[model samples]
Target: MSTRFSIEKLGAQGDGVAQTETGQVFIPFTLSGEVVTAARERNHDRATLMAVLEKSPLRIEPACRHFGDCGGCAMQHLEEAAYRDWKRDRLVQVLKGARIECEVDELVACAPHSRRRVTLSARRTDAGLLLGFNRHMSTQIVDLDECPIALPQIAGALDMLRELGSLICATSKAFHMTVTVTASGLDVAASGSGRMGERQRQIAANFAVRHGVARLSVDGEIIIEPQKPVVMFEAAAVPIPPGSFLQATQGAEQIMADLVGQHLARAKKVTDLFAGCGSFALRLAKKSEVHAVEGEAPALAALDRGFRYASGLKRVTTEKRDLFRRPLTFKELNAFDGLVFDPPRAGAQDQCRQIARSDVPLVAAVSCNPVTFARDLAILLAGGYRLIRVVPIDQFLWSPHVEAVALLEKPRKRR
Candidate 1:
């Protein structure tokens, strides 16, 4: 049945929320203060937006034609000022919910078309290979003619990548290709495609060379390497692993590194937990001795190499250990005067508990998820650490994801 709803606010997932007689209803692609008519699904409070009887003043035209249909972005319809405020408010709300109160800095804006890394889905169709993002709430792929969120080099090569997918695709099933635009050139990595024969492998290699791709890999195995894919972390040039994790944009990474470096500047020794390719450790080593701990061996090796070749840097050591399995204990953490940790979405709960018990004076906590970040901050707060401030970074522009760097300090008791 159709129902009338006045959107009250946007939920954490970027859906519009309405307080109805029955309960709160969530409608996709809606804005606050808009009167929307939607049809409720059977046995569910969530509704599908049918019409916007009244539009919000904060609503604006989306940049991409695939805004609503493509699942890549949700808040493109919101105006710039309102959108940034909303993103920053999300981090504040999460911190309040966790009962960890602190001042939050204004949102750090990342420009569109700044994304260097993108993962696209591809499948063999009757006509040819289809490539793009999956449609909203469906498994169907939306073939892209253009994507405003991706770097121009990546967006312009959509059709060429689709053609490359056809050659690499050994089965009728769908696969994923991660394209990263590095300093050398494009690094394409394909996975979930069936094994290729020698002839097919030869064709793939030829396609990569002819198209000027820096490197190509299938299921983590390197197929062709015309040039090394090197990504600079500050002064260090680190060779990136295929399909490895990197900050969405270089601007956001610099902001995060600056915040982290500023917090740990005075310390003589620092430990970076969950360090991936030495993003923070390389920059931190400018002032302090750094020990980087990571689970991925390849990433740790890259960090070690970057440290050795880079000149005028302090001592940098790496340890390959899964922090989730073996979090550094209080005694181990006590060796470092400063610490910085940037864990994945599943935030470092076990590690935070140990840090809380330790006496590290200066600490910088970086996170991609605000919820888990807030939870971890609460632990540190309970251990008497005073939060200096939290800065929210919008690296994934027009998307729900937000990155943050939080600084904290704990004073030592006098004897």
Candidate 2:
């Protein structure tokens, strides 16, 4: 079935929404104020855009030809300013919904082809090796001839990666191939490629060396290490663990570090919660003594090593603790003058409650999900902490996801 509808607004997922008398219909690749003809999906709430009868003025040429089908980017077709506004508005809208009041800064932009890390799906297909990102909401992989969003070093090596992928591919089932650009070279990690025998592992190792790969890890174990793969967090050189969490882009990481660092500059001691491999901890150690906490032992070890090897830095320490299971109590949190937490998408509901009760003079929060960020902000606000400012960062670029750094300050009680 086909129908013509006017796009009412952009949804959270960058899908153009049209409100029918029944409910809202989500149409992808369509923009607000545009009249589009769409084929009705069996799901009823989703529609496939057949054609745009009227196009929005904000529409712009997408940088990549794979825009719609690739699933890596969503708002690439929208104009630059509008795209940024949408990202910033994501924070503002969520804050209001959470009943928290604060001024959200404009979106800090990131350049195209700047993504330092990307996880590509790979498998041995009858049509040769299929290596690329999965289709939008589908298991199907979109084999890439080129990726404009990835660094040139990564995009240009697509063919080479395919050949390398072929070497370790023991089964036809699709697997993840995470490639990260580091100071030494490309660090490639593969998982779920099926069990590999000694011969298959040797072939993969040889291919990694010939192609100048920094390191190659399979199923969470290092198969070959040609060079020590490290990423510089400000002046400190930190080793990135295999399949560790890294801010999607180097540019975005710098922006976040600056935001968190500048806000907590006055504190002599800072505790970084949910810290992964000392992204902000080491940088803060340049000024304040940092206690980095994370659940992953490998990441904590790497952070400890980075701190030990770095020169001209204040004391830096690491604690391997599962924050979710047993968050630092309010009494424990009072030990730190300043605290910064960058939790995963679920946000830090449990941790924020403790921070809220604590007398930490300054707090900086970095989160990828606005909804959860707002929820946690509400918790902090309820506990006498005043919201300062929130800055949205476009690290995911054209994707609907937005990252934010929020500052909060607790007023001292006078005697």
Candidate 3:
């Protein structure tokens, strides 16, 4: 027997919620107020999109052929505007749950098809080389013939590389590829002992050569290297490597960096934690002294380069420290009057705790996950910090992810 239910709220993982007579069931590809026929026997607790008996106004056709199976995109079925609204609503709910009161500005949304970087998994299967994202909630690999979000040129390369991987056999399991687009050309790196063999490298070389690519690197060696690095963000061209972290959208990164500059206007001695390639530090130096800290050594090297090339009155310093294990001490924290934290989705809970216990007067936290940000906000509030403002910045487009910057001020002393 199947029980019917209506979706009441959207869950954190982009699943629609329905209150069944027995319990709540989460069905994918459904929107709020969507009354769809769901098979409630998949996970023994009643979870399945049996049929879309009724479609909500918010429903839309997903453009990607591998939408349901590919794990990279979950909300492709949702209309673009509706998807942004849902994500903004979720952020509001999270802030309320954490007792942080603030107004939510218009949610910024990135373009649907502006992804310049993509990481695909390769597996040796009986059929051949299966190159694609893992299937949702399973280890199954979904073969993606074409990706709607990736750049056209990279997408073509993906198709060609898939065949090349299959032919080499040595490239089957050991191959991992990251495709990045620079202003000059596309950059790809295939790594693993047997992965990206001589034949695969030759294929990449020929593809770049025929396409008139400016740069190409395989297995730590440059085949068609450029004389200078290609700039992704303003005045700064990141010589991105095989495994470096970069914003997927070049246009969106410029906007994000601009927002960072605005947020650091009044900052004096600023500390940028989890600073990658000095994205915030170099720019922040135009307005204030910046101390950049990051865990990755290569990123630190890039940050140093950015600092050296930076032209201005403000000073810049670099520190390679792992905040996860060894956060800044009170004495260390006292050097900075303000801090700009751009942590990963994990959020910097331990570092937040440390900052809350310090005397820093101003803070600007850039976050990708609202839940973790709320958790960290609670700690800051407990330490006498008042929520100032929250600005949503859209970095990842067409996906459920939302990036936001929250400003906090220390409370006045009671005399």
Candidate 4:
């Protein structure tokens, strides 16, 4: 039914909520107090905005040309201060939902084009090869002229990347192309591109060389390396594996590393759980001994080598283990004076459960998903850990995603 609706508030997923006679419906690209007409689907809460009868003052021009259709950003239409506030409130609301309230520091901001990494989708249509991000919750790709959220080097190279995509377009099926701008050069990794043969591999190798892409890997296999892809984590230069996890922005990373380092500065020994490429471990090692634990051997080896060559650092060790299946027992965790775990979006529920039982005096938890972060924090709170402060960091600029670092301390008596 096409009907007029008054937007009540913004939902958790960046949709505007409106209460209907029957129930509530969510409309995207809307703001609170705005009156808009939308087509509501039967038995569905989502509505497609048709027109805005009344506009909110908060609504502003989006930064990118492809704001609504690109699916790369969510809140680019909202005014700057309001966007930041909503992002910070996202963490607050998640914590409230988990019944864990504490001081949430102001959000650390991220700038446009600061995104050093992005994953693009590729496919060949009648027009030509399409290379860009997919539409929201969709398999459809939006061919791009420019992407304001990505680093200029990557954004400007879209035509080149599209041309290169044609060379490796093994099948009609879409594949993911993750491009990361490192200290050396662009590291391109394509997955699900079907099986690549010798001809395509050689062409892609030559393309990487001609374009000066530091490395190219398909489906976790290196196709070519014009130069070894390396990134600087604190003082260490770590050789990163293709498609390895990296903080979206260098500014956000430095802020997180600084927060983690300051939280555990007094400790003599620190354990960096789920440490990737030593982003926090090597930085912490300047003052305290660090044991970097990660699931991927390549990531762990990269960390070890970064630590080995880096100067003026304390002792650093590495362990390859999956914490989700085999969490460090409380007995094993008690050996560390401090602990920091930066888990993936699923959060670190299993490890946090073990950390709750550990008498480790200090703890710093970092996560990209607030929902799971709050769930894990509740587990720690139940085990007598005091929540100190949670700082929300804006890593994925203009997107709904936010990063957070939660600091907690176990009581002296408990230790």
Candidate 5:
């Protein structure tokens, strides 16, 4: 018999931790304050839960059948309200630890199930094309017949794609086929296709003909009718390639822009760092002078196009520069009165350092990774910045990730 225990707290990755007599174990979908039975032990001294002896008040019945298997969403089992509160607590803890005074506001709730886009990996099995996400921590594919979180339209296409899988030879030679469904149509990419030369092209053509996709791309480049630009928020429409980054949820993205606009409206001039396709810059341009900086040259071109269509007036100055390699100096950084950052998972550590030490009056740091955000916030705090407002945005629902928009004001000098 395995000794079991109750979870004390939720970890950063959404795992519930419980230390038994033997050792500590991380269990998924199990909430803190819940007692569970350990089923069996696995490699790396891990233990799986057999049954929940007692459920926490924060526990909720999982809505998805493939909740544990899919591995896409880790916290759907917890009550939505409790899950959000935990996220808010994480940010508060970060600020408190640094001795920064800030009002952690209510988190913006995202639509529970409205993801219009989904990228699934397809494997060639003896039976057929296994289409779904990967296993918990392994590359082994967990074939899902249906995904609950995906938009209804995209989820419907999974069956069609799976049935059509064997008809094409792209499955045999590729490592894993990529299936992306956009507003236009489906796009597929087949890697490890040295065996199929012309066959691969013909397969794509045949797939396009059968499904009637408005656009198709084998790799990053387009192969069929060009995909129309995606309309972001309520106003801006950007022409993004298949692999290009777009906010996962269109509705949530609009909310993000609204919050940014509200914040930037107070500033006379703002600098948006890692501003891919002018996500925040173009919209802020409607009210203030926005200097958008991005590493990708093509993204800047798209940002320019968005500006031309969204607003004929050019309040945005797009600069193509790699901030990681060469961070903007304090002298150059002082040009902006306010700053908005939407960096990648790495977060804007170096860029945040530059902003803290600069003379910018107001700063807004938006990040997807909380760990890096906290670290960067500490740097800003030490440099005479006072945290005023923190707004957590649940753009990726049920997932462990949390996005936040933090407003920091430079501390006033004491006479």
Candidate 6:
């Protein structure tokens, strides 16, 4: 049945929420203050947008043709000012939920076509191979002709990658491919595809070379390596391992790094926990001696090489240890005057506990998940650390995800 709903607000998942007789109903692709006609699913509190009876002033035309169908982006219809405000409000709301109050800086916007890494889904069908992002909330692939959020090199290579997927697909099963545009060239990594025969391997290699790919790998096995994929971290040109973790956009990475470096400018000794490929460590080492710790051996090895090759950088040491299994103890953490940690989405709960107990004078916390970041910040607040400021960075662009860099400092006790 069709029902008229006045959208009350936008939910955390970028869905418009409406209060109905039963309860709140979430409708995708609707905006706040807009009267929308939607068909409610039977026995479900959700509705699909049918038409907009009243349009919102904050609503703008989405830039991409596949905006509604593709699951890659959300909130693309939001106006620039409204979108940035919404993202910043998300951070503020998350912190308030945890009973932590602080000043949140304005949202740092990332320009369009700035994303350097993108993961695409591919599936083989009777007609041909289907490659692009999966349909919204579905496994069906939406074949992409253009993506405005990705780098030109990556966006332009979609057809080329689709062709490559045809030669390497060993079965009718769906698979994942991650394409990263580095300083050298495109680094393509395909996984979940069945084993490749010699003939298939040869074909894949020839296709990669013809397309000028820096390196191509399947299931962590290198098929062809025309050149090492290198990514510049400040002054260092670090060679990235296949399928390694990188910041979604270089602009966001630099913003986060600058915040960390500026916060710990005076500290002579610093420790970087959960450092991935030395994004912050490399930049901070220009002024301070840095000891970077990470769980991935390959990432730490890359960081070490970056430090070794870079000129005029301070001493940088790396340790391969799982911070989750074995967080640095309070005593161990005391060795550094300053600390910076960029944990995964789950946040550094265990490490934050240890940091809470320690007396690290200066600390910078970088997180992509605001909920966990708020939890960790509460822990630090209980430990008598004052939050200086938090900057929300729109790294994922139209997506709901946001990155933040928070600075904190503990007062020195007088003897």
Clashes of each: 0, 0, 2, 0, 0, 0
Candidate 6 lDDT score at position 54: 95
**Regions of model 1 farther than 4 Å from truth:** 1-3, 413-415
lDDT of each: 0.92, 0.91, 0.74, 0.90, 0.73, 0.92
1-415: candidate 2 lDDT, tens digit per residue: 6899999999999999999987999998899999999987888999888899999999998898888888888899899999999888888898999888778888999898999999999988888998998887689999998988899989999999999999988887999999999999999999999888999899899989999999999899999999989999988899989999998899999999998899999999899999999999999998999888999998999899899899989999889999998999998888888999999999999999999999999999999999999999899999999988889998888989999999989975553
Candidate 4: tens digits of C-alpha lDDT, residues 56-161: 9999998888877887788888998999999999999999989997889999999888899999999988889999888765788988999988889999999988
Worst 10 residues of 3 by lDDT: 226-235
TM for candidate 4 is: 0.97
Clashes of 4: 0
lDDT of 5 by residue, 152-243 (tens): 76677777766544444453533544554555565554444224456665775576667765555555555555346354634667665556
> What residue pairs clash in candidate 4, if any at all?
none
TM-score per candidate, chains pooled: 0.97, 0.98, 0.86, 0.97, 0.89, 0.98
- Tell me the lDDT of candidate 5: 0.73
RMSD of 3: 3.4
* Model 1 TM-score on a 0 to 1 scale: 0.97
Show model 4 residue runs off by greater than 4 Å: 413-415
Clashes of 3: 2
Q: After TM-score superposition, what is the CA distance of residue 292 in candidate 4 from its true location, in Å?
A: 1.0
Error of 4 at 163 (Å): 1.0
Rate residue 299 of model 2 by lDDT. 92
What 10-residue stretch in candidate 4 is worst by lDDT?
A: 406-415
User: In model 2, where do residues sit more than 4 Å from their true spots?
Assistant: 413-415
lDDT of candidate model 3 versus the reference: 0.74
Clashing pairs in 1: none
Model 4's alpha-carbon lDDT is 0.90
